[model samples]
Target: MIVVGIIGRPDSPWCHDATACLVVDGRVVVALEQERLSRRRFAPGEGPEETLRLLLAEQGLRPSDVDAIGYAWADATPEIARRVDSALPCGVLGTDRLTETVFPTLAAELRNKEIFFFDHHLCHAAQTYWFNPHRDADVLVADGTGGAGSTSLFRVRDGRFELLDRYSPLWSIGIFYEAAAFYAGLGWDAAGKLMGLSSYGRPSGRRFMTFDDGAGEFRLDPALRGLPSGGFTEERLAHEWTAIFEASAFPYAAGASNTFDYATFATDVQETVEDVGMALARRLRRRSGHDALLVAGGVALNAHLNRRLALESGYRRVSSTTAPHDGGAAIGAGLLAASVLGEPVRRRDPADPLPIFLGPAVGTAAIEAALDAESVPRQALEPEKLRAQVAEALDRGEIVAWFDGPIEVGPRALGARSLLSSPRSRTTLDRLNVIKGRAAWRPAALALTGAGFDAIDIEPAVAGLTEYMLCVHRVGERDWDRVATGVHVDGTTRAQHVADGSEFGALLGAVGRVSGLPGLINTSLNLRGRPMVLTPAHAVELFAEAPEVDLLVMPPYLVRRP
Candidate 1:
């Protein structure tokens, strides 16, 4: 069945914030994000133009040839916004002209095919639990907000998602940290930056939180003295967070700097995050009563907390898809539709789940075209040989864009769409930060081969399979001093685990053979505020505009600015 799934956000932080994914003939295709088309990260202001094109081309069929178009949207989206806007509380939603207008661009494609809508939270959970490599796993969905839900619990057995329950995001761990991060002066929506900074902190635990059992909720308590859970009121939190830290020894923005005091302050924040995470763990267990736990959502982005939850909860295994955020909804919505259509779900394990490199990939001609357009030096080497050459460059302390196969799903830079550099190069780290217009202190991920595990104290690749580089794991004492560029201040690294059979496995093996270290630090292929590039033309535009790039190794082609 030729099925297409698209998920969008109306008030997304970024524009053209739409992602289109397709499942065609047992192949998971169309990894294109709307941001690629508009050159905007999370493009919400635009429609899915390139997305529509890629889907059409992948099937060699026009829009009319598609079987169905599935959509995932926040429940009560327009009404929620209005209700939240006018201080009105609601249960069942009423008419919403604003949202129906947003009815999504899929309506444009659905004229000839069946149009279906998947619940927002359901879509998120489906992405991680239903479509993830682990079926029948305990499921948890957490994100900034899912319109109707901030978090949800579910059970999947025999190709079905049994709804367990949901909780409002107010006790919203995502919003709590987001507010703390913002108040900490770490740019807005840049909680990852704070996470990287957390290792430097000492976890003083002065800022204790309380769980309101009577109300079945949590709050920063003293800081949250006057507020009621009206559902993630950042305004209320802005004042509360400011008061708490100011009341504490740390100044309001003291956590922003990389100092002993700031690190200590980060410890407080980490403690707060952990406490909240643990509390959620307790609540989740009570709600589901299932041994397995599946967690997806922005809050799940807190690796330390996820580790804590895993250790504390009765659940033996905690599985989360790489993109727990709304981004994965495209994949989830696809699964929902596919399953309904009687498509077989794959549980072959993470090493080979759906071949998630479902986005756009450039052919030799596309790469060569980019090289010629940029007037950069060019050549074609066999991919295996090119891998060796690239590994050699990384060993020699070079930074190159490994613009390989199909783009990755979600936010992790899974090999295909990565900027490669020597893990040990401090200079490269600093330069890379400046290059990406982000923070150097924010660590890059070390993409390592399976064999490399013994050389260093790599975390159990199974405990953390961030082959997409989403979760953060501590760097082993043996490897920390070596992979300096990849290690956060806390001596932790976000490692994207790759296996030998995978396409990225070749690059890892090649790097291991040449560097003897078995890993290369990798970050996203795009610069700050930009989406990962999708086409050779997209790459050319970025290479011309990108300031930190030194070379682009798009297989069978090379591009280096003059």
Candidate 2:
């Protein structure tokens, strides 16, 4: 069966991160995010038409060739629907708009094919559970708000999902974090910045959220909730938090000179999130009697929380997908449709649990054309020589922009699209942050080979989490000096372990030969406000704009400043 899964709703304020994917039989044929092609961040208020068209064109598929279509929202159960209708404000669900507008438009474009709408949280759950190697596990989905609510727990036995517990949007950890982000003068999408700032301050023991162990429920403080309303927005929540904080013992002003107070607030929020996440994971393990845990949704993007759960959640194994946020829901929607139509869901090989480098590949001709258009001086070298030269440049404390193979599908750069720097010097980190237009406190991640994993102090069981840099692991005190650039103030590093035979792994090996460390500080190859580069032209544009980048490595061709 051929299935296509889609996300996003046109003109909907709540719908963002538009994406689409095509599944043939049981394997993913192609997946693309609208933001990558549209050159927009999150592709707000956009539809998946561009991405859907590209997915079909890549596989030489027509609208008539697809057997089923799956949408990532508006198919909740009757009970879920009722809860959403009662608890959420008008225009928040978007079910009516999807049915009356979006679905009909899609059907007309696709030759009136059968369209399947999936429960929002179910799609998130399916995206993680179906793609992972585990046969049975407890899945947790937490995001801003889904069709039913914000948080859900499910038990997956064999290939089916059973909902165990769910919470209303009133008790959302995502919203709590967003409020904190706004209060700290960071935007709603700045959760990552808030997380990084947490490392600089000690937790003050002030609680914004709490969990009930016996009931397995999380509660938001009434003070943060402000006035009781049907729904919530970041602006309203931020205002609520502001009033509460202003009346507290330490009143917070937006542009206050005291940086420590802001850091303290971030630390408190981060600790609270970790504590609630731990409680939820323990509850899921006990209720489902499962040894493995699968996490999805936006909150799963928190590497620190993921690390704590992996180490302390009482699960033998824990895993999260590279695209755990809404963009990943497209994959899950397709897999769910395939299963519903009596097709067996695809299971990845245990050895290669994540095959997420699913974007379009760049051909050598494209690279050559891009270079010629810029009239830049470049050289084409053999693979061995290219690696040697690039490794030497990195060893000399120069930064390189590495773009190879298909574009990565998620928020992370991974190995396919990255900025490379030597980890031996703290100055390298400073230079990288400047080049990428990021805050100085924002730490960079590391890409290493299997051998480099042994050099760091990390739990063996959580090795799977490191494959996509989804979890942070402690660096041994002894080896801290070796990878000083990658280690954060908290002594933890988010790392990715690449295969020995891959192009990136070969580069890391070459670097080891020169620098004695088999890793490089890896970050996305885009500026702070831009999306990762999708095509060779995009890569060349970034290289030209960021003069600080010493080398542009596009596999066989090496381009340097004239």
Q: lDDT values of the candidates? A: 0.66, 0.79
Question: With candidate 1 superimposed using the best TM-score fit, by how many Å does residue 307's alpha carbon deviate from the native?
Answer: 2.9
- Please provide, for model 1 over 373-479, each residue's C-alpha lDDT reduced to its tens digit, 9 standing for 90 to 100: 75766667887878888778778777787777778777778778788888887988887777688765566778777776667876656443354455566767777
TM-score, every prediction? 0.86, 0.92
Which candidate achieves the best TM-score against the true structure?
Answer: 2
Candidate 1 C-alpha error for residue 557, in Å: 1.6
lDDT of 2 by residue, 1-562 (tens): 8998888867576678989889899777678888888888998877787777777877888867888767787632223222222211111121222333444455555665555667788888888887788889899888877766878889988876888888877667787787677667776688888898889987778777788767976666665534324556545655665565555515356536554568888898899888888888877887898988999999998999999888888898899877888888988888877776778786766876366688866789999999889987889999999999999999999999999988888888888889999988888888899988887877778787887777566444265577778888788788888898988999888778777777788999999888887889999989878888888889899999998999999979999888
True-structure lDDT of candidate 2: 0.79
Misplaced by over 4 Å in model 1 are: 9-16, 25-27, 74-109, 112-114, 207-216, 223-225, 228-249, 253-262, 286-291, 310-312, 340-354, 546-548, 560-562
Please give the lDDT score at residue 17 for candidate 1: 44
